[model samples]
Target chain A: MTDSEKGENQEMLDVFFEASRAQDPVPGSDLMARILADASQVQAGFNPAPAVVSHPSAGQPGQTLLSRIFAVMGGWAGASALTASVCIGVLYGATAPDTVRSYLPALDEQTAELDYSYLGLLDETVADLEG
Target chain B: MMPLDTNDDISDDALMVLFANGDGQAASVLAYRHTGRVLALALRMLGDKAEAEDVAQDALMRLWKIAPDWRQGEAKVSTWLYRVASNLCTDRLRKQGGKRASEDIDNVPEPKDDAPSIESDLIARDRANALQAALETLPVRQRKAVSLRFLQELANPEVAEIMEISVEAVESLLARGKRGLAEALEAQKMELGLDT
Candidate 1:
């Protein structure tokens, strides 16, 4: 097409588009309300920064360092790990003596005096019986 | 930390930053500012009011979610929104398998104020409907390029940004779309009493 023809065609399309532009729909209140509701729900938990339980400046001015550790580790993951560690320590304390006694038979009171004085005779008897 | 009543004075990027910083009203401002364009784009792309509304809501919801991580100076919020809405429209069009699945004028609900006020306005409305029908006959990409570039009056660069294509590609699409629209409009000109 010639430049004039192209220009005219473009002008024509412009007019058509301008006319149609007015008919474009505006979003209604209900849609806005729904969007705002989503925003509210999302913003409910949105903090500008992550939690800082262990910060040096956190808690009372005279608080001890140990208190800070407990405060910081009080969250779910930290609390769960602490609980598991305590349970394991208690379990080991409860079962360690019995496990050691079984492994070392002399530690058993019933078997503490089983010394055989005639070791040579016993070995000779065992050999002769096998023969 | 943005003060209330400051929304109107702040840029969209600023509003987004405020929203990310836990300002709830910032979200409301962004949504109100951008929903019209998003809805209009979806409506033109999908040709269904309800689907367009859904697409608009989904796009803005994505925007809301991305507020925290929104990098300043990366892109304009409006351009980002147009892109999201465009992608959604494409996904919907792809799911339906073709542009033929888009709703036609009879099925799509138009605003009551869209009714013609005069004979010329009536012709314009008819031509617009014809244009929309012709647009739906196009491949999804071409339709999107044409709608965004011509109807939405976005610059070639902005259209490229929204369509995620190079400027030359956008120009090519616009040329092809214009040809198709011209041909379609030519067929209906006499019937609609438009100037030749």
Candidate 2:
């Protein structure tokens, strides 16, 4: 951690490095050849696909349209889940009396009114669809 | 989309890609370039030539198998190979129940006489033996960090990348490993007349 400690470590490392560099590693020529031979044998087992083409016309337009609609619905569902989680977290923080002290308590009244208006709109939309 | 050429200058990653496409020669080149480093690391870690050879071969073979899925520029090929080879050596060492009793290096075969003068060869061998003994005393991770950083001449970041640790962690390991080696080598130093 200190400068002297760092210098000593570096010096020792240099000595070890120099000593290791001086020693020659024995070659394994036959082992290397065998390994490559085995590798080639494994490579020979692979069968690559030839060139191919796909026609968009092979798919029906109606099926593609339905797939897009389902994809959009899935995206909406995910977004709704995320939004609901955020709203729940916010609401929980807002309503908890301890956390309420950290913010302007007067703002909660106006937020409740806005929440009612939003819920009323949801109800009306659902009722009209059911009717 | 260009055809891969064996004689052309290619990076290790490119060679890996060619090997993936079934060019055995590309694999051979990679093996030639990296095998010595891997074997040397394994030899230091395992202290047995036969096991080191097995570890090196297995590590290189894994490269050939994973060539198709290898993402380029992510890691140096030799660095990755050292990591794999070291891991294999560690696994074998663990399975064999920690360190084997130290063997007499006097029986170990020396390189051909043409490589070095007899006196120099003896001195180098003695130093190498002292290093090996000192290295064996360190814990496995420290030994690996020291070996990769010092022996392989890999930079700190490359050593950290291979060891799958942060740079700070690598530094700590190297510090501890070096101190341990220095302590172990002190007596050997007196014997080798390195005190002067």
Candidate 3:
């Protein structure tokens, strides 16, 4: 087609299409609601979920008061400190068994007098009892 | 308190920014502004109202999903939406083995009797339905180009952006599409009372 003819044709199509354009099919209300719902859902992702109050339950019986204290002491550092404390207590108990005995008058004299000979005497007493 | 008119005036890019910032009203504003165009394009492309509604919802859903990542100045919001809607319609069309559910002309929505432009409205409605029928007969790309350029009144560049084609390619498709439409419309002019 000639340039002039093309221009005229385009013009006619424009008018024809303008009418078509004006008659945009009204979207059903249900569709709009669904689309809006989709929008809300996506936007909801940006918000943080609501915080729920935690409660002690039967399943977590191991969460004793001491363990709870250790947990509250914060993460690995606190846990290491708690473990170190328990290790120190155990070492003191094992290496210094007489420390508490020395504090008691009844154990004080006996513990002070205790020697390797006492072990031999105990062994003989056990043999006599068995015999 | 933000004035509601301010929301109305906010650009799509700004509205998107607000949406990303967790402003719920911004999403509503954006949806209200563009849903009609998206729905119209899908309706014309699919020739099925139900499918068109699906496409519209899907496209807007994508829009909502992409709000946070929406880049300002990268593309026009309408262009992005129209492209998404177009793809959805294409997918639906493909699923039916490339056959559109042929719409009976009688089922075409009639102009309301109380419409001020009743006479003209009737003519336009018939012509529009005829055009839609003719559009369905074209290749998918041609139909999309013609519908975007003529029916949607998008500029060649805009149509190209939505179709992901060069403007020259868009023009070519539009030319060929218009020719096919002309032929189809010519055959229907008598029955549609275009001559009268």
- Candidate 2: where is the Cα deviation over 4 Å? A1-16, A47-131, B1-8, B101-116
lDDT of 2 by residue, B11-69 (tens): 99888877788775776678777888888888888777777788888998888777888
Clashes of each: 0, 0, 0
Q: What are the models' TM-scores?
A: 0.69, 0.66, 0.72
The CAPRI quality class of candidate 1 comes to acceptable
Model 3 CA lDDT for position A2: 83
DockQ of each: 0.31, 0.23, 0.30
Give the candidate order by descending DockQ.
1, 3, 2
Model 1 misplacement above 4 A? A1-5, A48-131, B1-7, B99-121
Query: Please, what are the lDDT tens digits per residue for candidate 3 over residues B58-138?
Result: 999999889889999999999999999998888888888779666875335434444567677877787777777878889
- Residue pairs with backbone overlap in model 1: none
Pairwise DockQ winner, candidates 1 and 2: 1
CA displacement after TM-score superposition, residue B135 of candidate 3 (Å): 0.7
> Model 1 — interface RMS deviation?
2.1
Candidate 2's residue-wise lDDT over A64-95, tens digit each? 76555545556578668878999999898778
